[model samples]
Target: MRKIKKICFYVLLGVIGIPSYAQDYSISLLPFSTDNYDEFSPAYYRGDIVFCSNQKSTIFIDYTDEKENLPPLNMYRVEEVERNVWGKAELFSKQFKSNANEGPATFNSTGSEIYFTRNNNNKKKIGNFIDKNNRLGIYYSKFNRRSNEWSEPTPFKYNNPAYNFAHPSLSEDENYLYFVSDMEGGYGGTDLYVCKLENGNWGAPQNLGPNINTTGNEYFPFIHSTGRLYFSSDEHGSIGRLDIFYSEKVNVEWHKPIHMDAPINSRYNDFGLIIDAFKKSGMFCSDRQRTSDDIYAFTPLYPMFENSQRQEENDYCYVLYEDGAENPDPSLFEYEWTFGDGNKARGLEVEHCFNGPGDYTLELNVIDKLTGEVSYTQAIYPLKIEDIAQVYINAPDTVEVGQEVVFDGRKTNITDFDIYRYYWDFGDGRKTRGIEATHFYTIRGNYIVQLGVVSREDKEGNSEKRGVYKNIVVVGSLKERGRRTSD
Candidate 1:
């Protein structure tokens, strides 16, 4: 049983591609000063990066000793000054705090609501009472653009008490919240959970399931504006420490996650990912730098798949019929037949047929010995001939006065009858010729429209004739006094 499971696992890896397990993505590390203890958890907000760092100097001791126990991490922002280069880092509002370990921040699409992880001595005491191992929990704050400051941070409260939650990401619409938790009932050490926001409150948290979370920790999930998810995982195979990976939602379900390759991942730990929706560039945290962990900038190159190919060809043949009977002979009165398959036949009407059922772009290249260059090309869908007398008239059977109506006389089983001509009697003194004829009623009355067709034969032995009749009614115009009375 174990061997069979192992075989299935390997087959899955093969289908997704083995190189993805160890591929390294290209990245540029953020320049670091020697003063910082660590720098990580870079999140995107309005074309800038909001991250955490411990760049304390002798003159600036930011955190208290109790806060230092966890880590002296403070949130910072780096704006893009040029194409690839980032401007110098600056501290966010004091409401974010320079005194505790504050990091891993995400902003709503409008950059108004901020969610970040902050561990204070007071929160640590509560965490310790709940679980001696609980290190930190995520917090939320809102930025007031008018005041240019953030509101006081508040601990995010979820239903789950046994789990340690951090690294919160709000969906683009702020309707869903995704976070990482080292909670029980998970497939691995830590897993990603998403909770829907209902009536402005966070609802139940759902595990991202085995497709994303594994026996190892999965953290730092950043959902791009396009709905693709990026996170770090050690459970799935990685090049080194927890490497950054991405998964895209193709439809309702999430597709298999892909690893960002070599240069983006190394023997050192890498996490925290962010990307701008419009610019297509973003930043992540990596310990690949020489001494301490630092944030890096990267642009993702999406792969493309090949498209399926198709080919089609068409062929046509013809047969001639006269008096509802097959006829043979080429030299007769002038006749032209079009197969509706880009092929034509000339003589006194030849029965031209298509190779198959499809839209055939055809042209009737007719050469009148008298009126040269008489050509007619039309697009047609030639249905299979089922019976001989299946004639259809396209016009309505009833119409009002002054309305022009058309009558179409069509035959099914008689193939070689193309050289035939149509005769239409509008029953109102109007007569016309051709397969289709149009006429307008001059007076109000019920009239029986008639269409007659005669097929030309080569030897003039006999002629096949078919006709159909339909009734139409035309209404007279009302007088002005009667129209007003009706209204």
Candidate 2:
């Protein structure tokens, strides 16, 4: 990863102050990126990646883009060599309008069906708008298992020759189709839109509304399996020309989109992002070089839940109720409950928060109402309150990458269990031993700090051991994480 980062861009240095907001993300340009050709809008196909490129294909014969002076964009496939590496790319398919512009595709779970964008060239004409020149629209193709061939591409049912509708992204369940279009009544040159597939037919297209679509173009939407909608937009006040933003659906409405942090979003045009369900790794497009758009892959140093609300606060408060009732018309008697703590209350039920972890004897007594004195003891209970019997890790959950962090294990509480040694795994292939230890991380990312305790061996040659794990986010230097448009 360090090598990949160096290959991608220079590491930031010399900045002094802290970043206003920072995230642990690392990005590297895809090895398949070419010098002059444009590559963007990557879609995952099985283990390989299918992306659109303007590089000439099949004997250097292809149509040229009407405006860009570049060759027509065609879908290309590249097998993943390994993590952070890719093989040479080849023409994705010939069944689709390969000679015309086509790419930015989405595949169903089985890869048998595909939804993509291409120049309008279907035979079926709809309504009076039929004079199409280069307007793009959504297209679909199905694989024939027996013939081992792809069916001829067909335009979407809602496709119209009068407007452009491209960059189709299908949901994982195949129940929703998201795309970009310049159709009338949209917020900008292009806006994110979706259509539900129900009863074997695609429903009317619905705009994602102002929260996502702005006066600036919003396009290249990728719906992740986690119900998150990620797309690129020029309207959300980005750090660059265009930036990728993601919005989670709250209830039935889409929440306001969040701008992706730096590195994932550079100052140049950055958009068209697709991430896996776990969000640990994925790819996006960026033109930071000012030459042509290129595909780049990104991964998180720390896993998710970094800033989410911590788990329900450790609960120590408990409720206690008297078990038996004193009969014989005890209207003249009152109840008095004394907890193990130095506190007493008069009631049938009592709720208390203990001061510390220990064992004590609690007593319930019947008091004489007139004399205000204890009559007799009704219940005697042995109550034991102890901290969770496990190895405990005490440290900050978030810290700078190179800042030394201290881990304390003296708080560990186990009844009758003696610890002989304390061990630490820094989650970065580093380990040490101590009841208290200090460690620092080299690069920015999230690491699981582990603490292990070993008990002394008894006469029987048996010992008890326990280990615990906690997540700690190691942020990068402010200079490195600072948002920027260029080097």
Per-model C-alpha lDDT, please?
A: 0.61, 0.74
Q: Model 1, stretches more than 4 Å misplaced? A: 1-26, 32-36, 57-71, 120-134, 159-162, 300-487
What is every candidate's alpha-carbon RMSD to the true fold? 22.4, 14.5
Evaluated against the true structure, the overall lDDT of model 2 is 0.74
Give the 10-residue window scoring lowest on summed lDDT in candidate 2. Answer: 1-10
lDDT of 1 by residue, 1-487 (tens): 0111111111111112224332223567676423235777777678777777666523555334342333355778878787776778887656776444576778887788898875533333211222233345778888878988888877787624445677888888888889987767888777899989888788888999888988777878988766678898765777665678987553244656877666676656767777666635667776555576777777643221122111111234446433332332223224455555567676544677655445544333434446545533222234453332333344675665545566666532335465366666666543556677666664667987666556675696676655556577776434533675888
lDDT of 2 by residue, 392-455 (tens): 7888889875566888888876566878877777776545577998776656678887777767
82 Cα displacement, candidate 2 (Å): 3.5
The pairs that clash in candidate 2 are: 267-485, 301-446, 302-446
Clashes of 1: 10
lDDT of 2 at 32: 83
